[model samples]
Target: MTGRPAPAVLPPSLRGWLGLVAAFAASVVAGLGIRYAGEGEPGRVDARIGAAVDGVGPPWRSVALAMDSLGEPVGAVPLVVAAVAGCLLLRRPRAAVFVVAGVGTAVGTATLLKHLVGRTIHGGNLSYPSGHTAFLTALALTVAMLAARRRGRGGLGLGGTAAALLVLAVALVAGAAMGWAQVALGAHYPTDVLGGWCTALAVIPATAWLVDRIADRLVDRMADAGRRGRR
Candidate 1:
């Protein structure tokens, strides 16, 4: 036996799978409401959250600015490269692909949604579904899913529950951090950040499942072809 580890399967368990499906649906609905309510301006929720950040001083403002930069192209490219490289270093080619594809798709979807929703802030800037928030959340989700799968506890048991919780925790942390930064910087409305977070939640699990399914099918076909040639 090679004794090497198998590639990680996403969702990690039946409950995890169901949870993802529910999250996706809820996120989609929430995003739609945010879009409709805020199109062309901030919504009721955004208004309550306020348009300005007060009492933020040097380090906190600096930190917020830094966090905001992480969503930009210059910042995001390096992060994506590092994640892909790390996955390849661990000999997880599928995970490498998942990181690239998932992050890109999530960010791209947010961009498309911004245009479609036409939600604007601070003028005509399309801002529903904060792209920066989506980018970080997507990256976090990809990493969490990989970590949970690598734990090799993707069964319908306590381990699976822990894995699911880990993914949720990571996603929330990433989403909240970025969302806070965007709102503080007045770069987006609070509802916009929420929309962005939901966008990632809705997109990532499905992307992971698709990547796994396609990669597995390709590997199986290649293995079959090799056997037929040998015979």
Candidate 2:
């Protein structure tokens, strides 16, 4: 009997995925650019425009800013706790590495675009895409993906259901908090944050699927190798 390794197929092209990604990206650029550009100069989502009409002033604005600032740290706490627990239970040393890479690449893309766009920059406003929001979203989504994948393999269906719910809730809340912080802090226009989210998710879906597929293949390969070695 002849023995040979199976061919590896990294997804996307096999599923007409690349075309969809390109279309989505083009749409994001057009939609976000138009909405953000229409807003006129950028600064703290123009809280003053509506507030002045309402006759609101001072500490209220300050309070809003403070709340925005408060959200990031608060949201981050859940992720940190989950990550620590993951370390103890799953020992996935590469989790943080992949997360950092995804976030760093996303943030860097935002920062570069912010400068390259040549829009006015003050108080974090030269925004095509909001970096802070994107960073947190990337982290949140990545963790959620990891949690879901692990849950799928666990034998306890009830526990897995609970785990999946918890992961989804945390990721959604954290991601929303991050977006809220950017909007409240006047760090970016709502359009900028939305666009950044689109960009991040667009990159993420394909990458995440590929990573998961590759991981499964690698695990199978390693197990096969171990069995061969034993024989």
Candidate 3:
């Protein structure tokens, strides 16, 4: 029998890579719109969406609070640790590294964008790209990418297309959920959440690809060195 295929790592095919590039481009375009259209205040779009979502009670508020916590250090740390531990159990060291690197890069990008864009919501708070949304979306994207790797044929039997779609779908859903939570609680404008979502989308795929490239090269070098030593 043929040996099991290697882990998917990042996008496994040319089409997958193209799709990620398109996604990154789309995110950059959206971010540019937000940055130039209204740098420090809510635009018309943000006001309308925020007005619709801003106030709620009971179960939704409770749910939003819980979801919000997932992006915080208190909840985010444990979840990340669990993901890394699970990757080790599955013998996927590169994926474990990706889990850490991907999330860190996404969050850092959001923080940097917040400073650069200088969008504000509540009295001088830098809010253009919600860091909470970025964190949760990054976490979700990392998990989805790992799941794709485990499937062996680029996710659920559909090759690289399936893997790409799976990663994007998971990231989108997670970002939307967190975005809604942030809006509902009046923590951010809708555009701010949108910026955060796009930031993760723009950053994670690139981060995954970079991690794979660097890690693979290092592994190859190590293997060559070992062979030379044995010789």
Superposition TM-score, candidate 3 onto the true structure: 0.88
Model 1, C-alpha of 216: deviation from truth (Å): 0.8
Indicate the residue-level lDDT of 112 in model 2. Answer: 70
lDDT of 3 by residue, 68-174 (tens): 99999999999999999988887778788888998999899889877777777777788878899989988998888778644542235445666677777888899
C-alpha displacement of 36 in model 1, angstroms? 2.8
lDDT of each residue in 128-149, candidate 1, tens digit only: 7789999999999888777775
RMSD of each: 3.5, 7.1, 3.4
What candidate 1 gets wrong by more than 4 Å, as runs, is 1-6, 9-38, 51-55, 152-158
Q: What is the C-alpha lDDT of each candidate?
A: 0.77, 0.53, 0.78
Candidate 1, TM-score vs. the true structure?
A: 0.87
How far out, in Å, is residue 197 in model 2? 1.7
Please report, as a residue range, the 10-residue window in candidate 1 with the lowest summed lDDT. Answer: 149-158
- Per-prediction TM-score, please? 0.87, 0.57, 0.88
> How do the residues 110-136 of candidate 2 rate in per-residue lDDT, one tens digit apiece?
677666554443544476776666666
> Backbone clash tally for model 3?
0
